[model samples]
Target chain A: MADSRAPDPTRRSERSRRAIYAAALALVTEVGYARTTVEAIAARAGVGKQTIYRWWPSKGAVLLEAFLDLADQAARAADGGAGLHGIPDTGDLAADLRLVLRATVDEMNDPAFDLPSRALAAEGIVDAELGAEFARKLLEPQLQLYVKRLRAGQEAGDVRRDIDVRVALELLVGPLAHRWLMRTLPLTHAYADAVADLALYGLAPRP
Target chain B: MADSRAPDPTRRSERSRRAIYAAALALVTEVGYARTTVEAIAARAGVGKQTIYRWWPSKGAVLLEAFLDLADQAARAADGGAGLHGIPDTGDLAADLRLVLRATVDEMNDPAFDLPSRALAAEGIVDAELGAEFARKLLEPQLQLYVKRLRAGQEAGDVRRDIDVRVALELLVGPLAHRWLMRTLPLTHAYADAVADLALYGLAPRP
Candidate 1:
C-alpha cells in the first residue's frame, strides 16, 4: 500500500544509511570487530536486518562503507566542505603540510575515530586479505593525496627533483603513524610540525 | 631425591627454558595469541604444564619472554656475538645506518620472526596495556639503539645537534614498520637504503 503522507523514499533511504553507518562505528568501537555483528548494528541503528543485507553482502562490507562515510565526514569537516580535493596546496609546502598534519593529530586524538580505527587496524594486521583490502581501498588513496602534494612541490622546485617522492612522503607520514600506534611518545601538533620541518628539510634540493 | 644421573640441574633448567621459549613462539605463530594456551605450549615443548605456569604468569608473559629471547638471538646473529651494543657506529653515519636497516629489512622478511611478531603486534594494538608493555620492554630499547647511534653521529659532526634524535630515529624506523604492517608496498633493502638516505639528508647541518 502506498502512503501519500510518507517521507520521500530516497531521503528516507539516505537517513537510514547514515544511521547504520553511525551504529556500525559505535558498535565496532565499543565491542571490537570480533564481537560486532550486523544484527547488533541493525538493532542499534533501528533498522531492519534485511535492509542492511539488501545493501551490503557482509558485515565487513558494511563496515568498510561506514568508514568511508566517516572519512568523508572528517574530510569535509577538516576543510569546510572543500570535498577532499586533496591536501591544501597553499603554495607553502611546509606550512601546508603542518596544517594538514596538525589536523591529523587532532583526529587521531578523537576517541570517535581512534578506538574504532585501532580495532580495524588490529584485525587488518592479522587478516592478510582484509589488510590488503584496507590498504587498497582506504589507505593508499589517502597516501596518494600526499603524492599529489609532493608532485606539486616538485614542479614548484620546493621538493628535490632527484628524490623519490614516494619514499620521501613516508618520512612525513610514517613517523606520525609510528608514534600514534606504538605510543612511543605523545602525539601533538608540535610533533607534527617537527615532522613536517624534518621531512621538508630532507626533501630539499641538493646543495 | 636428587637424580645423580641427570645432566647438571642448571643445564637442564636452561634447556627446558629454551625449549619452552621455542614452543611458545611456534605455537603463537601457528595458532595466534587468543588460541595459544599454557598447556598447549607445554605439550609442544615436551615439558610439564606446571613448568610454564611456574615460570610465567600468563600466556602473554610467556609470549613476551619468547619474543625477548628471539630478539636476543637475532641480535647475536646480527652482530656475531659482540652483544646488543646497539646499531653499528662506523664513522660514516649514513653507511652504518644503511647496514643496520638492511639487516632489519631481512629480519622483517623472515617468516620465523614475521608471523609470530604480527600476531603479537595485532593483539598489542587492541590491548593497550599489552601494547605499552611490548613497547616499553621490546620496542623502546631497540629504538634507543637508534638514538644512541644518532647521538654518536651528532657528536661526530655528521648530524645536526639541533635536531631531536628521538624524532629523527622515527624517520629511519617508522617507514619500514608502516610498509610492513600495512602491506602498502614491498618491504625491501632498497626501501631501507632510501629511508636512510632521506633521513640523513634531513638531519644534516643547516647551510
Candidate 2:
C-alpha cells in the first residue's frame, strides 16, 4: 500500500520495492538462504531480474536489506514509531532493559521475523563472510543500542562504572539469543526479568 | 588403527565406525549439511551404503552421532580420559567454572570441532526437528552438568539459594555459546574467566 501523502510519481517505485522486499523475505524463509536466488526473488515479486540487479549486487545483499526492512517494520508495529533503534530509558535501568527484552521476546516469536531470520542466521553460522556481514549490518547495531543504554545506566549510577558496558551487554543479550537460537526453552517476559535481575545482582549470595 | 586391546572380533566394526565418523564430519564441513549425503559419506569412508544404513537411520542421525563421538574424543583428549559427563567440583565455584569454560573455549577453537559443529549448528537453526534433537541429545545433557555443579554451590553456600539453577546455568553457557556461534569476538580463556567472575559477582558496586 502506498502512503497517501506521497507524490503519485514515486508510488509505483515504492510499491515495487515493497513487493521485492516481501518476495525476498518469503523466498528465503521457504527455501533458505543458500537456495534462494535473485532470479527467484524477481519472479516471486513479479519484477524483472534486472530490476533487482539494479539495486543489490547479490542475493545476500538483497536478503540483508529485506531483513533490515522487516525489522524496521516490526519495530514500528510494536511501538508506534519508536522502532528497533531506541530502547526506552525511563530512568529505571532494570525496568528499561526488561521492557526492551520483552519486546525482543515478542519479536523472536513472530513467524514473519522468526522464519526468515532463522534462515539467514543458519547461513551466517557456517558461511563466515556472510555471517560477518549480517553481524555488522543487522546484529551489532542492535546490540550497540544496549551498550548505549548500559552506558546511560552507568551515568545514572544504576550499573557499575568499572564494568565494560560492551561485555555486560552480552550478559544481557547472550542468554536470550542462546535460548532463542537453540529453542532450549520458552522465552518469556518472566525470563527477561530474571535475566535483568541476575545481571544486576550476582548469582552468588549477597554478603 | 585398531585398538591394541584384544576383543578381536569387533575390531573391524570399530574401525568402520571411526572411518564413518571421520568421513561424515569431513563431508559436512566441506560441502555443508544439505549437500552431504549418506552415499557420499559411505563412499568417502570406503564403506558400503548398506553398512551406513545398518548403523544409522539417516544422514542427520549419522552426523549427530559423529558429532557426539567427536565430542567424546575431545573430552577424553582434554582431561586424560575424563569425558563429557561432569564438570570438576573443586569446592571453589568460580575456579571450577572458569576451568570448565576454558576447556570449552579450547574445544570451540579446534578445527575438527569448529567446522562440522558449525555446519550442524547452522542446520539446527533452520531445521526445527534436527535442532530439538541436538539440544536434547548433545546440548541439554552438557548444560545439566552446570546445573549439577551449581546445585553443589548452593549447598556449599557459594551460590544464592533462591536462583533457578536451570536459568542460572544459561548465565554460564549462553554468552560463550552466543559468541562462539556468532563469531562476534575471539572466544578465549580470558573471556571465559570474565564471564565466570561476572556471573559470581553482580554488576552492581560491591558493598
lDDT of 1: 0.83
Q: How well is each residue in A1-207 modelled by candidate 2, as lDDT tens digits? A: 766685674777789889999999999889888889999999999999999999899888888889989888877776667888689989988788788877788788889888998988888899888888888888888888988988888898888898887887778888999999998999898998888888878899988
Q: Write the per-residue lDDT of candidate 2 for residues B83-177, one digit (tens) a residue.
A: 89699998999999998888888888888888998988888889898899899998898888899999999999999999998998888789898
lDDT of each: 0.83, 0.87
DockQ of each: 0.48, 0.75
TM per prediction: 0.91, 0.93
What ranges in model 2 sit over 4 Å off?
A1-7, B1-7, B79-81
Q: Where is the poorest 10-residue window by lDDT in model 1 chain A?
A: A198-207
TM-score of chain A of each: 0.91, 0.93
Give the per-residue lDDT of model 1 (tens digit) for A1-207: 887886789999999999999999998888878789999999999999999999999999999998877776776665567545688889888898998888778767877777888888887887789989988998888888999999998888788777888778888889988887787788899999989888777532335
Rate residue A56 of model 1 by lDDT. 100
Go through the candidates in order and give the clash count of each: 0, 1
